[model samples]
Target: MSVTQEEDDPFPVDVSLFTDTFCQETVYRLVGQELKIRQVFGANLGVAAPVWDAALFLCHYLGEQSVELSGKRVIELGAGTGVVGILAARLGAVVTLTDLPSVLPQLADNVSANIPSVGWPTAHPTILPLAWGQDHQNFPSEWDLVLCADIIYLPETYPLLLQSLTHLCKSGALVYLSSKMRKEHKTHDFFEEFLQSRFHVELVNCDHGQNIHIYKASLRKDL
Candidate 1:
């Protein structure tokens, strides 16, 4: 998607460039279904404002025939537009879509748009505010799967994210984290250092064009 900049526009030219993709809703096809995600752009929203490519990659991986979703309990961390979690719910997983308190409104709107009010056989996704380490304890650790997409960009949050992941995986929940391999973000270090230390991490898929890598993780028995 492309946006044209106006000479009289008050916002910065660079910001205007993002208008088309971030200022409006987008429709995505996943798991043979369509999801309309509402995206909001603002200075405060940052990366959580729009649906990222990593999230789409994870959705594709989950839709694979080999993967099973029926009856699984899934929780998605940093679910910006609720696409991944919404797809999981449609595929028969009981899902929870979580993010910072500020992001919940848009996330909830996306969930409502994609998931019907009635006739949904599986459990609908629960939209909630989850601030990684701070809120992990509030949620039960019995989830069958934990989903994260493009949430590892901020290095300062690494420890906090690890804390949350450890807590969530305590009951043997499998984690699928899809991240863009951005060099400046040091995304690789998180997996090689913090995550591998506590959980068994494996690279399950990669989308070269998008520079996204999907990793499957489980808590280590010793930990």
Candidate 2:
């Protein structure tokens, strides 16, 4: 079930077929605030790119009834369409959105359209290009929290993803991941084995009654 690392196509099939030339507007409720998000449909799917419901759940868990988002640095890996990462910024965390270079342009566009509206508190929440298991030295070595949603659909990237998370997480950083529980069990088994040794993982159901799990692990002291 592992996916071989294939070169991601820069064009993403076709732009006209997947997205309108104009930006699409959407709303996400987080921490009791209805934050606005602007997104463009993928050039290939023509559907609104999927947002990570798990990240939303985490936001609710962390901010429940709190209005202030202060003093947190966040990084989101595999930020397709960049929704969760942007929401983190809107919530007041200094956020960085990362994904493959091929996917960055669209992600940048989405961030550009929404960041102004959110009035991001500081010169923060930047977007950058990064591939899993690759060099990330240009970015901060540790983040208070790291996020990923539905990035584990392909098993081949699992090891790379895990390694990248280990490298970027701070000493006591919390890692939140969400997936739709696909039929493929290998991906699940692999992560369970790989992460159990390091993280304290838990499954939390979402408002939609879907099982979204949260994985929290501190960096190994010896490492």
Candidate 3:
């Protein structure tokens, strides 16, 4: 699939779907609004192209919690497909959807399609490139809420992810992290050991069938 980049185009498709690439769309209704997401599948896209189960679960969780989103400064780390961040924007939060540099175009496309300029007046989601540990310092630490979903599968990234989270939550930002309990990846160990050591972690929600866990954490200022 070749993406058209015409400036006048309402929805400029930036995704180039090769013979090996495939696409799927999912429409989710949350907080009385509908969000259409495009999930791309390809060998080189890594884990940042598809909308994960944890991301969907977090959307529902946020809606159910009815957390005050209006005017809140929100940042979503590893914002794959921009579903959670877009939903946050729809709920009236000033949201920044971020991921690796390679994933920004697709993330931007999803954000543009869902949160268009005309209908949405207050909240417009911003797309940016954020590589966890390395780029955390480049961003300010004044966000009201920080979000992460299904981004804990890789063991090598644990320390880096922690580093980023620690820096982002430095100014008392609340962190909402959703993860699938993958034993092979030792996901539980990250929460029990590394994360707990640095932050105050609480398991807020869980999907028993999917083995997904949603945690609410804050930086341990005492440390």
Best by TM-score: 3
Off by over 4 Å in 2: 1-23, 43-48, 65-69, 116-118, 202-208
Better of 1 and 2 by TM-score: 1
Say which prediction, candidate 2 or candidate 3, comes out ahead on lDDT. Answer: 3
Identify the candidate with maximal lDDT.
Answer: 3
lDDT of 2 at 99: 77
> lDDT scores for all predictions?
0.83, 0.64, 0.84
Residue lDDT tens for model 1, 25-118:
8888888877888888854355778788899888888878357888899999988878888888888889988987767888878777886545
Model 3, residue 111: C-alpha shift (Å): 0.8
Task: Give the better candidate number (1 or 2) by lDDT.
Answer: 1
Q: Rank the candidate models, highest TM-score first.
A: 3, 1, 2
Off by over 4 Å in 1: 1-22
Predicted structure 2, TM vs. truth: 0.75
Q: Each candidate's root-mean-square deviation in Å? A: 6.4, 5.1, 7.1
**Model 3: per-residue Cα lDDT over 59-99, one tens digit each:** 89998998788889999998978888888888889999888
- Tens digit of per-residue lDDT, candidate 2, span 1-223: 1212327532223344443445567787766556566555554333225455655666675666352446588888878777777767776788888876666777777777666554776655777888677656566666788877766656666666667777786456777776656557365664577666555666543444765555455566654
TM-score of each: 0.88, 0.75, 0.88
